[model samples]
Target: MRGLFEGGRICEEFSAGYYGVCAVGGLISAGTTHLAITPFDVLKVHMQVNPVKYNSISTCFTTLLREQGPSAFWRGRGGKFFGYGIQGACRFGLYEYFKKVYSNLLVDQNRSTIFFLSSASAEVIANVALSPFEAVKVRVQAQPWFAKGLIDGFPKLYASEGLFGFYRGLVPLWGRNLPFSMIMFSTFEHSVNFLYRNVIQRRKEDCSKAQQLGVTCLAGYAAGSVGSIISNPADNIVASLYNRKASSLTLAVKKIGLMNLFTRSLSIRIMLVGPVVTLQWLFYDTIKVLSGLPTSGDDRTDVEQIRTT
Candidate 1:
């Protein structure tokens, strides 16, 4: 296993093979972590779709347990795994690709702007792959009678609403994900830089693996928490639209209310998203290190050269 990963190191930086390795790492990181938290996702959907029924976190758990049994928590595992797996591949891989592309095009411009543009561009494509699975996942989790999982949910959704159904939430999905990705990537990059420069007072390469991964986790959590809050309203609207709580974005906002859209199920989301994002960065960087590559957000020298040129 170690040898297999180290083989990936032969790929030159920003090369196709390098991006492929990053994509595979992202697939494993996002798929597994998101799948692991299926229960929380189920609860979060329920809380957003029917806050009166699912109320508090504890209450939601008990109600789901009593009404639907333990299996209810894992309702959308199939969609969560496959959907996010593909999304992760595109997101992480393309972010790196576009980051380099943008750096070259916008030479000597703000690095933060590059970060924002790269992440935003990657997410636009990623969400297209994610929207259908998300549609099925939300439906399966929120409406138990809809279908068992992605296998059935896909066909059922298609049969009822055709291909359009799967993509109906694309706009809101983009709305939720674009800002989230921008914040996540830029914040993680800047946070990692800050930790190394101000707190650690050492070069990232000088830090031990454990210390470096610790920075990744802390930065990821900060990024996730902040992004979750900023994108919470759109997240709620996506949930509401998918579950038939609202027919359109306008109605979803009107029905869910502006305040509830931002606040509803937010704490649970932070709890869920914070660790998920942290683990994603941890797993992503761990794979890179194991593959003899440096962790992300550590290419200041190359970036500086690009900017100056």
Candidate 2:
């Protein structure tokens, strides 16, 4: 176990093992945090699919509680857990891998560009892993009678709609997650750099573990909130499509209206995403630290210098 965690063993020199560890960290962070917010997710989906019936967050909460009882809040949690776990693993792991690859490839090595490209590339694949589960999760959440959770939901969806059923919303999922990830990773990386350079007034390596983690939390929240706002329209469309609220994306947008797409349920989503993203970065960095790796986005020049030496 110690060997697994040690720098020179499993995580040696940022090889495949190191990326694997990062992937594990991503899974733990995303899976647990998303699972913990099942109730709020249910509310968000209802508000998106049937805003008239569900209405505001408070109204939706009360309606679901009254109509379906406590279990209603946890609908689709299994899909949420496994779906996000796989997505997170691929997202974080591939981001690291691509970041390194892009860094080495680009002669100019522009950090922001690297951040955006790496995250976008990574999310493309990650969302593929997440889409099937996301389809099940949305159907289960928006219409509880569809199935119990991922267990029954998966088979029922398959039987009813076949393999295509699992991927029906893949386009909307991409529409939502792609920009979300690009904004998230780039914002997080820039925010971390800014905080350390401006507010913290020190190098990241000089900070204690607690302080580094605090920076991670702050940066992650900022990124998540921004990403949530940018992605909300696509998110609503995903829910609308999966819930059969609309036949297609264009039709869904028309039914949802332009303004409602951006505004409705936006606040609740920001609230949910902010802390979830914060905790994810905190957890991911914590695991990296535990594995004797530096916190992410910490002094790229320094790392490069070390590699050269």
Candidate 3:
């Protein structure tokens, strides 16, 4: 019995070490993915905040291309790496970590509502930790002349904004990310779980890994769509509020309106922000499952197997 317990301990420890390594590697991959698509992120934020100015993603892209040159797409890779990389690490790592914590703490995870809350809670932690980084990323992305890439962007943003600058969009960011992450993590978790338990498991063990990944993404996309709609107003506000002068988050929220924030926001022009967020989530979650990373967990260690695959 003692030997079995010792073996289990060894296994768990081994799993944890592997999980960390996989998470870092996955983070790098995820970071690269973010860098690759940053132009779209910028475009989307612009559409949300300055829609009248830019109109749509296509128009925004064309304007940047025509005005700044085609290479303008790579304008903010510097801050993108720093800000987005940290966000990816915190989000993926914490989410996996929290899911397990939630599951262990609340054994009734079988309950759908519990799963929703669990994911939401985990995402909130992630959003808070990543907010400062996001502020940096947003400013860098929005400002065309700051620097060419991540290496220069960090110091520049820090130099100009100081710590406060790095956190420029934090309040609205929290408002947006809180619900986005919550709904995203929870919905993604439930979606993956449902797929794994029902569609994949019931279908057959003979199902290919690709089949599983497809199902996981379908689940992820579904949840992402809902989160995008629910939080569109806040998301748009974050992008807009950061560019303007503001004393505090509350002030910004006040500007946007504490109640019925979506309808009140002048900055967010995307009346259809939900579909956009949905698209973004679909892409994001598809990447997660395809990479064999954890969909949601309270502890990062349990995801070693998922990550390694």
Better of 1 and 3 by lDDT: 1
lDDT of 1 by residue, 1-309 (tens): 122354656577788888998999999999999999999999999999989988899999999999999999999999999999999999999999999999999998888999999999999999999999999999999999999998899999999999999988899999999999999999989898888766776777667778878998999999898899989999999998888887898999999887898899999999999999999999998888887777788547544444454
Better of 1 and 3 by TM-score: 1
Best by lDDT: 1
Candidate 2 local Cα displacement, residue 165, angstroms: 0.9
| 141 Cα displacement, candidate 2 (Å) | 1.2
Q: What is the lDDT for 7 in model 2? A: 43
Tell me the lDDT of candidate 3.
0.56
Give the poorly placed runs of model 3, Cα more than 4 Å off.
Answer: 1-15, 109-125, 196-206, 245-247, 250-309
TM-score of each: 0.94, 0.93, 0.70
Report the lDDT tens digits of candidate 2 across residue range 31-114. Answer: 999999999999999899888887899899999899989999998889889999999999999999999889889859678889
lDDT of all predictions, in order shown?
Answer: 0.89, 0.87, 0.56
**How many residue pairs clash in all the candidates, one count each?**
0, 0, 11
State the weakest 10-residue window (summed lDDT) of model 3.
1-10
Candidate that beats the other on lDDT, 1 or 2, i.e. the better one: 1
